[model samples]
Target: MTSAPVTQPLPPQVFPPTLREVMLRPRWIALLAFSLVVAGVLAWLGQWQLGRAVDTSPPEPGLTEVVQPLDQVVQPGDYLPEPLVGQRVEVSGTWVASDFIVVSSRFNDDVEGYWVTGQLRVAGAAAPTSIAVAAGWTSSLDAANAAADELERQVSADPTAVVQVTGRLISDEGPSVPPSGADPLTITRMSPPMLLGRWHDTAELNVYRQYIASQTAIGPLDDISSPAPDERSRVNWLNIFYAAEWAIFAGFALYLWYRLARDAWEKEVEDLEDEQAEALAESSTSSSATGAAESRG
Candidate 1:
């Protein structure tokens, strides 16, 4: 007598995890927490930026002489009012070590020399903003390089050290290409974009069009003599520009979270669709095989 064959039970239906379900996963949850922290920090920084964007009351005459906060005097990406070109501003930031570069043909009191410059990553700004700082001046190229090296060493040793630099907010000397047969890396002007090109960790860097001539040099360097500008421009748009940055930053922070979630959801949906297709294909093949076997019987 032939024994009856036992049929195997069908496997339970497989369903893809919903977006909400995927987000609730421990891995995604942890990621969400991290994003939230980042967003919160950005929000706070944007708020800080807002407080300085557009000073409602125009700076009275002689504002140039009064040491104003860097953010109060000019926002990153805004032109320094021509009159505020010689404004004495106090900037708080940490030096970006690898960004210390030597710029040639700087004149101090009409004496031509080299200037050691560095990128000053602004303090308390969530945005990756920086200001070019002419750290010191030297008549000798060796001295300029040495000063730049020393500053880099000091920054690497204590990367987070925040230093306050009081300086004249001078307009950028537009960048110039190296002269014929000159070293390709040679930078002749105090241009932020020029210096930024040589700077490390410059991804998404926001820099001031104007640079700072430090009142005193750092680490074995001579001070940069910055005489006041002959004229100043009228208008106070610094605060207004800064406020706009804050709004953009805040919106970006929230968008980042949504983007991450949406990307994950999209990836999950694709995976689910692929899995469902595979299952259908396998089921169809099995049915075809079973029908063929019965027909042959």
Candidate 2:
């Protein structure tokens, strides 16, 4: 008998690539490079924030305690520097008695009170210059008003008298809005701009952007409770937290690329399985029909 010809074996189909393999494709690699660029920019911004959050050259301890001239420390209309906010400064000026006003909501050692504020026309300036002064603090509103009235009378009696004041120079407590139905004359903050509005002879007046919290009260009120500023820490926890957030964002960028590639690979695998199933079903139907036709013949 003739030998049966050897049946040729069909070649095996190539296995589909894994998710990692899909990620290595040129298109996905380009996307990875773009993500790297974005991450780099975010990291740079985080580093910038870190640099600004801490003070590298803090002033010496008790530097603000040493007395200095008001003009030497800061000029009229100039903003006070942080290191000089509570600086002990000496200034010569004449008090505008009528300009003494009462400011409510003053706090002294956690106690809510009031402040009797005044305008001191700085002495020896070529033009008219003034600085706001929180003369004293009191618990009762009537007491605050009485002190202001007395100070006004004293300044009026000696309008030309030059007085020398030594106190801690401070930045202005910018103006605030009064309560909805509060009195028009009621003020609650030691704001130089607000005091200037109520000051007389303000034509061409040059005013200090900062103010003074006098160590000695002008009348019967108690001294203000302004303590020394605490030394700042070198390490900024907030900046560190922000840096961590940026690092997380960077990691997310890479993870996004991996996820997209994995999704695409999974879809390809599903389609391949569907195509193979359809081919098998068609082949089965063909075989059944051929056998049926032969049997009928």
Model 2 Cα lDDT, one tens digit per residue, 129-243: 9998889999999999999998888888889988888889988888889988999778988889988999988999999998899888777789988887676676778988898
Using all chains and alpha carbons, the TM-scores for the candidates as numbered come to 0.57, 0.83
Model 1 TM-score on a 0 to 1 scale: 0.57
* Cα shift from native, residue 79, model 1 (Å): 1.6
Predicted model with the maximum TM-score? 2
- The number of clashing residue pairs in each candidate reads 7, 0
Residue-wise lDDT of candidate 1 within 58-173, one digit each (tens)? 55777688898999888989998755778999989999888889999889889999999989999988799999988899999998988888888999999999999999998888
Q: Name model 2 segments beyond 4 Å from true.
A: 1-14, 75-79, 124-128, 179-181
Deviation in Å, model 2, residue 164 alpha carbon:
2.5
Residue 202, candidate 2: how far off, in angstroms?
3.6
Please, what is the whole-model Cα lDDT of each candidate in the order they appear? Answer: 0.82, 0.85
